[model samples]
Target chain A: MTNAIEVTGLRKAYGSVQAVKGIDFYVERGKLFAFLGPNGAGKSTTIDILCTFLRPDAGTVRIGAYRLGEEDRQIRGMIGAVFQDGLLDPLLTVEENLRLRGGFYDLRGRALTQAVEDIMKQVGVSDLRRRPYGKLSGGQRRRCDIARALVHAPEILFLDEPTTGLDPQTRKSVWQTLHGIQREKGMTVFLTTHYMEEAAAADYVLVMDHGEIAAKGTPSQLKDAYARDKLILVCHDTARTAARLREKGLACTETADTLELPLASTLDALPIIQDLREEIRDFEVIRGTMDDAFLAIAGEAIRE
Target chain B: MMGFALRNLKVFFRDKAAVFFSLLSTFIIIGLYALFLGDVWTSNYEGVPGIRYLMDSWIIAGLLTATSVTATMGAFGIMVEDRGKKVVKDFVVSPLQRRSMVGGYVLSAVTVGVVMSVVTVVLGEVYIVINGGDWLGASELCQVLGLILLSTLTNSAMVFFVVTFFSSTNAFATASTIIGTVIGFLTGIYLPIGSLPETVQWVVKLFPPSHAAALFRQVMMAEPMAEAFATAPAQTADAFREMMGVQLVFGSTEMPAWGSLLVLLATALLFYGLSVVVLSRKAR
Candidate 1:
């Protein structure tokens, strides 16, 4: 299958300040792709250029077979975007906002109404359809924004910081809904996020810094290549657990809450968990994370 | 384009404060004319036949002309709000063409201007009749309606041009205030054009909506004007009409109705063309 998005030598600058330095990347079709970076790392500039909102100084961008400069209108019909800011009209109801967005794609009358209904249901905002957008909670508003973008059923959906400012529960719920929609529709989900855990869900990740690609790989590949693993034991008394583990000739670091034991290999995980099962309230083999991998590769945290 | 235009209209009407504020200038002008300006203008024409009707029609004509400008400015407020709120980016990235987006805004402003102007005309006629003035005949009413359309086109295009320079609601609101206050002076609503200095009278003549106001006054005040000046000399009535700007005079030549119509049409075309260029450039 053709890639959902393709770019070569993509470059954009605001006057003397270069927002997106020359870069190259492609997102595979029907995959969850995350562009990970901190603020001012050109994540938005790259997305804006890809979504046809900003004109690049130099590049060839092809979104689902439509060239960026020449076939923008066609490309627009094939892609949807949920920006960092709320695009829904606060004065309008959820249904009205969806209907308005649908109209932009030329859906009208019964067809437009049905699309709004289906999308509202899909995003679990069906009950909020009659409520004014301003009256919705933060989580509800983000869901409505996603629903608005989905009204046209674009082949690829770009979400820029989709879960920013959301509570942990709401963020998890939003991700679950996104995954369901992506799986059901086989839509290419391209997103940029500040949270490394969010990027962990991507089939592929591109870590960017200073307008350049710092690293690109699957989450596991990134972790394996750059990060280290450890064993975490949570208990009521971490000092007691650490002493007991130390007596068994297994060394561990004791923090106020947990004992962190280094793991040389996965083969050692089960033996340790079985040995410490009685003393520890919780025992788990901790794999290296995308956050660890990102720090390892960039030599700095994703967020300052 | 119609979809976007309808969305703009919906957004405008949904915000009751914005709707009231858009017509706020028109209401103020009407209030002043009824309470204070009416008495002063009537006193000037004391002992003259049909003074009440003539002065009432004069003020109503100016109000109708002012309606197009103020309402259109209010309509453009939606565009500014969309941009300020960043909702415009959604449309920018949509399948909608840039021209269609601009067309939506321009069309909605014209629609709002025309609609509000019609309401003003209805209310104005009612007020005039209550004050011993006459209702416009059907033919004259049709002529007045046609003038409103042209005036709205000119107003919408011109306001859209100014609005393109702003991307913040605060800035747009400030512009609306400035335009609302200045429109009366430019259209000779606050005082008769002849009463201003000669240079200012020329400025009024050159103002775009002033021609539309002159056109509306010609149709609205025609009967009352004839009755008020029936015993006066032909030159006296013509001079009074020109002085008050019910008729525009260029040096020695008194401009015919078509001359004012041509000026309005030219204003509409010029500003519309300019705004399209500005919007196209901004779209990129």
Candidate 2:
């Protein structure tokens, strides 16, 4: 089967400032892809182009079989987007908004009604269908937003910061819902997020910075390439413990109370911890996280 | 197009405050006319037969035109609210054409304008009859209805054009408040045209909605004025019509009823064309 989307040298600029400068990537069907970036890193501009809301300055894009500019309406028919804000009318009930969206795709009568009901049930929003969207709770509103996107049953769903403002428990629930939908329907999901832990859940990840792609790979591959595992030690004598580790050809940095060692991999921490048992009072071996890997690649921690 | 238009209408009517505020100016005018303006104007021709009926018909005609203008402006609030919240971006990304969405808003406003104007005319007629004026003849009522439809279309086009430049709800509110106050004077209801200075009277004549008011007055008050001034001279009635703005004169030329209708039609076309051009240019 063809890839869900493809873009080559996509570039978009507003006046003199370039928002997305000549980028290339593609998403396979049925894959969850995460595009990670800080503010002004061009993730939004790129997503805007992919969602057909913006035109690239110089590049070509193929969404399924249709070209971006030449066949935007057809692409619009095949994809849906959940924007960061104001995607649904606040005064309208959730069911009404979904029905309106379904009607926009030319679905009518029983089909539109059925689509709205099915999607609401799927997104766990059936009980809130009659509530005005503005009156919904935070988590309820987010689920309704997702249901709004699925009313037309688009093949690809583009989520822009889907869980940005939700609490941790709500965020986890939304992700579970997304994963369930992607698996059950074999739909492709493309999401951009500032939360590193969220990107760790994606099948593939692309990190962008300064209007360019800083890195792209699966979460494990990125962690392996750019992050390192750490072995931390609190001992009777922190200074002496560090010296003893350096004598064994293992480098360590000594804090006032602990000796820190960076290992080549998580398994490397086993032998080092075992060897330092006598000198250590307590120890912890911490594996690399998506945050650490991102910091290594972007040269700074992701800011909220 | 029809689906979106229906959505706009549903949203508008569902918001109870929107429906009430759209007719707010009409209610305010009726109250002011009864409380103070009524005694002042009717006192001039105290003993003239049918004078109260004539003045009542006259103010109601002006109120009908004012209703069309204000009600349509209120209906555009939905569009302005959507734009302010950036919900229009969602519609843009959908499969619907941008032109169709804009058409939906304009059509809904026209519907609201016509509905509000018709309600005003109905109530105004009842009030006139209660004041002892005879009901309009069949042909006269037909002419009045036709004028209401024309006035609504012209006002909708004009309102759409003006609303294009305002997206924030605060700006819309401020504009509405200003238009609500100014429309009364422009319709020559608050202050009669002949009583105003020569320059401001020119503004009242040039305004397209004022012409709608004139056309309405010509149809609605014709019989009552004729009866009231039967023993009086023709010059006396003509002068009274001119003073009260039952008819509008432009630069020493008395404009016929057809001339005012032409002005309404021409301004509607001009504004609609300008609106299309402005919208197309604004699009990427």
Worst 10 residues of 1 chain A by lDDT: A295-304
Q: What is candidate 2's lDDT per residue for B1-284, written digit by digit as tens?
A: 77887788878888889888887788889999999998899998888898889899889889989999989998999999988988887887789888889999998899889888888888888988998887888999899889999999998888889998898999998888788888999879888898999999999999999999999999999899889999999898889989999879877789998899999999999999999998888877
Chain A superposition TM-score per model? 0.85, 0.96
Q: What is the C-alpha lDDT profile of model 1 across A178-248, one tens digit per residue? A: 99999999999998997899888899999888888889999988888877788888887777777888889
DockQ of each: 0.76, 0.70
Per-residue error for A122 in candidate 2, Å, reads 1.1
Worst-scoring 10-residue span by lDDT in model 2 chain A:
A295-304
- Kindly give the stretch of ten consecutive residues in candidate 2 chain B with the minimal lDDT sum: B1-10
Candidates' interface RMSDs, in order? 0.9, 1.2
Error of 1 at B220 (Å): 0.2
In candidate 2, stretches whose alpha carbon ends up further than 4 angstroms from where it belongs are A301-304, B129-139
The whole-model C-alpha lDDT of candidate 1 against the native structure comes to 0.89
Model 1: TM-score for chain B: 0.97
